[model samples]
Target chain A: MIGVELRLMLRRRRVWLCWVLLCALPTLVAILLATTRLAPPPGRGGAFLSAVVSNGQIFPAAALALVIPIFLPITVAIVAGDTVAGEASAGTLRYLLVRPVGRVRLLWAKLISVAAFVLLAVLFVTLVSYVVGVLAFGFGPDASIGGAGAIPSLSGVELTPLDVVGRTAATVGYLALCMLALGAVGLFFSTLTDSPLAATLGVLAFVVASAALQPLDAAAAIEPYLPTSHWLAWIDLYRDPILWTNLREGVLVQLGYVVIAFGAAWANFSTKDVTT
Target chain B: MIVATSGLTKRFGRVTAVDGVSLQVQEGVRFGLLGPNGSGKTTLVRMLLGLVHATSGSIEVLGEPMPRRARTVLPRVGALVEGPAAWDHLSGRANLRLLDAAGPGRARHRRRRVDAVLEQVGLGGVDRRPVKAYSLGMRQRLGIAAALLREPELLLLDEPTNGLDPRGIQEMRALLTSLNEAGTTVVLSSHLLTEVEALCTHVGVMDRGRLALSSELGALRTPTGRVLVRSPEPDAVVGLLDGQVVDRRGDTLTVRGAEPAALNARLVSGGVRVTGLTEERRTLEQVVLELTGTGNDRVDRRPREAVVPGRSRGAGGPR
Candidate 1:
């Protein structure tokens, strides 16, 4: 089942198009930063902007952070949303089920494929950005800088190349893990409806609502647990003597959500009528 | 028995799609599910395949309980439900290859199996063409190819010839006949009575979620047809004939059971004018129409059931 999904997803021309666009965005942005003397206005991705202009090597890290809250998650949600609903809508879910595959196994295959897609998407964007950053700008020590408050809670921190490398890996891993939970939400919604677009948009709507509510104190009590709230916790990984607090919390929270959300999906799908 | 369902029921809210449908399909028999639209034909097939859970009762497939044991049983059964469905972007062969990969069994020799099915379905030459380019008939054939991949012991097809042209329909009929002859129990749901007559050895007739009749073809079909006579005094002729006259038109009469030669002689001796005399056998289509009280076109509402004669072959088979 996983093999079938992989073949179906990877062979689609649009998937490749998405990859090109995702990878190209950061590279183009990095090139623009390296060539221009203009600095982004303060307090709005400014620190990451300054870091990108200072050293090409920091481009990958900056790009990954820039897209973490929105672009990467949206892409992941689209693929994940389409996994089950697309098949159902196309009237293929009936055939797939009649393959006699256990419902849980089918759901697991879908989850794994979405997770694979998320991993590749993030890696592609980060890898291409790193290469572009190195080509456009010179590689060397990156600024002890990132988006504002990336490490504001901590001080007296310094990093060598190896430290930066290690922290960056941790950050990427954190981002990937968080995205998996997001993908699970998408999958959950996929089981509820036969329209992939509707499922994806439903996940996006939740993300948007979470982001919309973040600034308001009224929603704060539940805000911390929202996927949007933990989405950027990887920023803490960049701090030397890396702050493990929110990163660990974020991991636990995301993993918890994955379990509950995926459990609900499996419960609903296992006995679903499969009318399509 | 390959399949035996007792009191199987499925209710979609207020509408009971399948109601206490107790049916059976024998091993190595060509069984056809005959019903009018919305009479639970598709729903019954879906339940048998475990696509739709039964609301009550039990279904056993190949000696293994259905749905509960569907996972194990399905791997040994092939099905084409509600016409053909395939990935439009993939070539016909690619689509089959993907399904074959997902089906139970070793991947080895699957390539040869695909080739054989494609050839069998007359799609060997066009297997490379993307499914989006296929005509409806071609796609239907592809669906059949997918079902045949595992060489399953049972084949379930619902309206398999819905989109096929005359030639394609004939090919499908021939394919199904050959498959049954080779000992694969075949179950198909269709309104094409002729197709069922030509292909099935046994039939289960349903109406409004109830089985009106299920029996061997030979049992349902009478031994002889009636003598149709055209006469100006048709109603008068009804009185003259001692045997029962089944139907009457403005100038014609259909007399059943009585030999045509005897009826003609009686009519001539009775001084009745007979313009035309011909023997017309009762067709499977005629039987279904009379049973369901429906003509050719499908009707959404389940017509009231007709009390058809003949007992169903034992919950399994005549044997």
Candidate 2:
């Protein structure tokens, strides 16, 4: 069922359009940084921008940083939101339920498909950035930067080729999990309503809402638990000592959401009346 | 009984959609659930299929309790709920393929089975088109093909001809009848009396969330026409009759399950002078309306008012 759903989801022109949007962001960042060499203001994508200016190999890290706030989460929201609500609104959920698939099993298939979408979306952005970076800026030994280190020559150094590849994989894998947590949120909301647009917006709202809360001093105590809080923690992967504290917290938080969100989704969906 | 529900009720908030409907559909019979638009036919069907949870009461399908053992029973019983609902983005064949995958496992012949069902529903060559592009009739056919994909022993269809053209309706009737003859017990709900009259052997008519009547189609179709008599003493005349009177006016009444000679003799003996006597063979629609009280508003007036039917009365349909 998951395989079948994935195939169906992938066939949609909307899905392909989302993929294009995801891949385009990183490619744009690479193209702009490669041509202009103008430094992004100190706080933003500066570290990644500087890294890209120095070595093409570091562009994937830069791309992941640039898009974590909006583009990637939005793409995930659309796919995950459509998981169950789309089927219900289309009037096909009843047919699927009437088949041998149990509601629990069907829920699992939808979750898996959403998680798969997250994986594909995140990987596409990273790969596009890497390819464009290599072609334009030129590849070499990669740069290593600490968490919160998006500036050039400021707490940044070079790394071996193997380290660059390995770190890039870990960065993407970790970010994918964070996006999967968001996907689970969308899936849970999908089960709650028959409007796919509403579910997608709800998930997007979570990401935006959490990120917006980051500016509040009082909200800091509750900040670490938010899915957005640790998104940039992936930059730790490029550090020399490889800081795993924030990365570990990020993984655990994502996994925690993955479990709770899915458990909630199943609880609601398994016994849910197929009214749509 | 292949399908049975005892005191099955479902209430949507303040409205009781299905009020204690206990239905029994016999095996090897084409059963029709007749009702107006919001008569709870769809709700009852949903409960039977475990698509909607019953507020109370038990439902047994094919000798097994439902919404509990639904996983075990549903795969064996196919259904087209409400109307044709399919994945519009998918090709008809692709939609069936996915549904069949979720159905009983027949790994190798799955493609062949899909092909056969598409051909059976007359979607054969056109099934490869995206469902979005298919006409309503084609979508309905695809829905039927999906339901028939598993070779289910029992098929539950809700308003199957809702979106079909006349030709499509005929083809659907023929398809279902042939399938029923092939030993599939069919339980269908429809407002299309013509289709039900032509296809169903038994029926359960629903009105205002209640079963107004349930019996064999033969029992429902009484060859005897209703006895209408106009008399000055209407109360005295009604008091003289023993059988149920279908409709009543100031000096006129239509009596059912009655005899003209006996009624006339009874009225005359009772000294109730009558102005007119006639036997009107009521159509099935009139019988349904009278029995169901769907014509309650007009039926209330005691004069010769046009009992304009077809439009719903005080009680509104489901939103």
Candidate 1 lDDT tens digits, B7-87? 988998898878898898899999999988878898888888888988898999898998988778999988898888988
Instruction: Report clash pairs, candidate 2.
Output: A46-A150, A47-A150, A47-A151
- lDDT tens string, model 2, A1-276? 777777777888888899898888778777777678875765565456765666676777777887888888888899899989998998888888888678888888888888778788888888888888777776544334422222232246656667677888988799889999999999999999999999999998888899889878989898889888888888877777788899999999999999999999999998787887
Q: Residue by residue across B5-119, what tens digits does model 2's lDDT show?
A: 9999899899898998889999999998888878888888999999899999999999999989987899889899978887788889888888888655766888899899999
Top TM-score model: 1
In model 1 chain A, where is the ten-residue run with the lowest total lDDT? Answer: A147-156
Off by over 4 Å in 2: A41-46, A141-154, B225-282, B294-319
> Candidate 1's residue-wise lDDT over A1-276, tens digit each?
888878888987767776787887787777677677565753476235555554566677778876777777778778888888998888778888887667888899899888888788888877888788767765544334542122221243544556666776776777788889989999999999999999999999978987899878988898778777887677677665677888888999999988988999999998888777
Pairs of colliding residues, candidate 1: none
Docking class of 2: medium
- Candidate 2 chain A least-lDDT 10 residues: A146-155
lDDT at residue B124 of model 1 (Cα atoms): 82
